[model samples]
Target: MSNLTTLLALADSRLPTGGHVHSGGIEEAVTSGLVVDLASLRAFLVRRIRTTGLVCASLAVAVHRGALSASAGESGDLETDARTPSPAARQASRAQGRGLVRLGRRIWSDEDWDALGPTPHLAVAAGVVGRAGRLADQHTALSVVYTTMTGSATAAQRLLALDPGDVAALTFDLSALCEQTAAEAAKDVTDLSDPLLDVLAQRHVERDRPLFAS
Candidate 1:
């Protein structure tokens, strides 16, 4: 497949990576009344994209650029853990990572799959997949950042019965910010943290009947 096609396939929400089930803390945000309408949702997404999103994209870029590996010690996974303060968020990331690793191993041949262990962080897995797919660092970063935004936005749409058109427009309007974040992420690894997201992730785990995993 072409490079663009490969990137699209990896970024597709229907990739069976278990990404659809996780809201990236949006469910908890909604329950907590932090995000109610389109305006609030946009604010939430902007904060997310600037913080965890940048961190994820940067880690993926580091892996894709050969600056980091998926190994346990001194690897991208540890960095991911350090950047992610909540245990629930870490678990969710590993769950998605396992799915990505499973799919990636079936589709691509790479020794990094074995090195990634049974449960790598999502960003580390994404980087390995990007490298194996021969994708550019920028493409990899963009893919990570895009998914980071879309996953939560999708969950909010479902939870609030939001107009799909408005949701689509909201994401489209933020495309430039996503691109800018991805560009910066591709340049270096980041340790940005979002305490509210971390708290929300933990709270989501405690919800009696949560819609999303995290």
Candidate 2:
């Protein structure tokens, strides 16, 4: 496959990485009435991208660059755990991380995923897999950030019955921002926090019938 196709496939929602089960807190945001319309959704997306998205991008770049590694024991998993104040968010991340490792082992055969430990962060998995595939660090970061934005938007679509076209268009419009954020984050993974998202994640996990894991 072509280099572009390879990257695209890695970022594809159909890749079976278990991304569909988590909404990046969108379901909880909607249930709490914090995101009701396109305007509010966009606002929430912006906040998320600036905070959680940036951190994920940084982690992806670090793993891809080998600055952090499962084998080296500097996986940055603890940092992600610390940044993610919510236990539910951490669990969701590890679940996705495990899924990525499973898929990566099948695709790349030689990579030592076990070094990353029993459960690395999702962005860390992306970095490891992306590096093994010889993908660019910026692109790896972009993929991570893009998923953060798109996953929530797709969840909102399902929960609110919003216009799919409009939701997709919104994602398209945010592409440039995602790119910029990824670029900056690749330069340095800034430590940031989003208390509201943490609160929502905690609340979502406590729900009797939560739609998304976090």
Candidate 3:
């Protein structure tokens, strides 16, 4: 398959990465009334892309570029752990990372996979997968940024029973921002934090019967 095809496959929500069960903190946002309608959802997505999205994309790019390696003990996983303040968010990320690593191992035969340890962070796993797949740094960054928005948007749509057409349009409208953020991320790793997101993630874990993991 072509690189584009592989990238698309990796970005697919149906990739069996256990991604469907997590709402990227949107569940808590909705429960807290921080995001109710299309307008608020858009704002939430925008903020997410600027904060966690950028950090994730940059980490992926850095890993893809060989600037950080799990084997060399310069793992981006540590950085990811430090940047992610919420234990819930960290657990969610590692769960997804394990899924990605499982799929990646089945597809590629590389020793680098062992370097990732048992549970790499999602961004670190993404970078390793991108490198193993021979995808461009920009492509890896774009994938990270794109998923950062789409995953939460999808959860919001289901939770709110939102019009799919409206949600699709919203994602389409944010494509430019995704591209710009990816481009910036490909240039360098970034450190950004969102305290509200952290709080929501923590709160989500405490919910009696949460719809999503985080």
Candidate 4:
């Protein structure tokens, strides 16, 4: 919790970088009738929080952990990130990721900031700050989980006709999964592979979407 204030503030929906425009497939999923109720949303979000959050946490630690490097963990994390099945999902990630890093540089302390041009991906931004904040595996994991969950929930406010209270409740539920995924990522990874996510992401490039630009 070393940089809790920064983490919470930047992650807040109010900060706004077009995050509301995307739903992480919740819009498409619900529109496609794949998700409709809180129960379904919960299930969808759980799988999402677990897989996506774990990837974010794993990559954050991997890219920055140095001596405690997690190359194997990164391979697994990248596997899922690359496995996103829908074009919208992949574009949504890259689009929001760009916004995350772009905004991060404008507001975050530049002293430690990398002049690496753009963030390239959201995980990079999360990892950079996660390392600075002294967040362990669990905390780091939850941050990314909540980030994606909240972003999707925010979009869901309109996408699913969900109430504000329900959104908050769903976010709370997602918190646990983030922690769980983080714990898994914290452990040594025996093997790493993820193709489904990548395939979906590649397809996302072909789809025509208004919200997220892949």
The lowest-lDDT stretch of 10 consecutive residues in candidate 1 is 66-75
Worst 10 residues of 2 by lDDT: 69-78
- Please, what is the whole-model Cα lDDT of each candidate in the order they appear? 0.91, 0.85, 0.90, 0.57
Model 4 spans with C-alpha error above 4 angstroms: 67-91, 111-115, 133-137, 188-214
lDDT of 3 by residue, 1-214 (tens): 6899988998788888787888998999999999999999999999999999999889989888989875524668888888899998999988988888899988887646887888788999999889888899999999899999999999999999999999999999999999999999998889888999999999999999998878
Clashes of 4: 9
Candidate number with greatest lDDT: 1
Model 4 pairs whose backbones collide: 82-197, 82-198, 83-196, 83-197, 83-198, 84-197, 84-200, 85-200, 87-204
Which of 1 and 3 is ahead in lDDT? 1
Ranking by TM-score: 1, 3, 2, 4
Of 2 and 3, the candidate ranking higher by lDDT: 3
Best by TM-score: 1
> How high is each candidate's TM-score?
0.97, 0.96, 0.97, 0.73
lDDT of 2 by residue, 56-105 (tens): 88988987897876452464776677778789888888899888889999
Candidate 4 lDDT over 67-103, as tens digits, reads 2332223432354355444544555655665676666
Tens digit per residue, CA lDDT, model 1, 54-101:
999999999888788777655798889999989999999999999999
Query: What is the lDDT ranking, best to worst?
Result: 1, 3, 2, 4
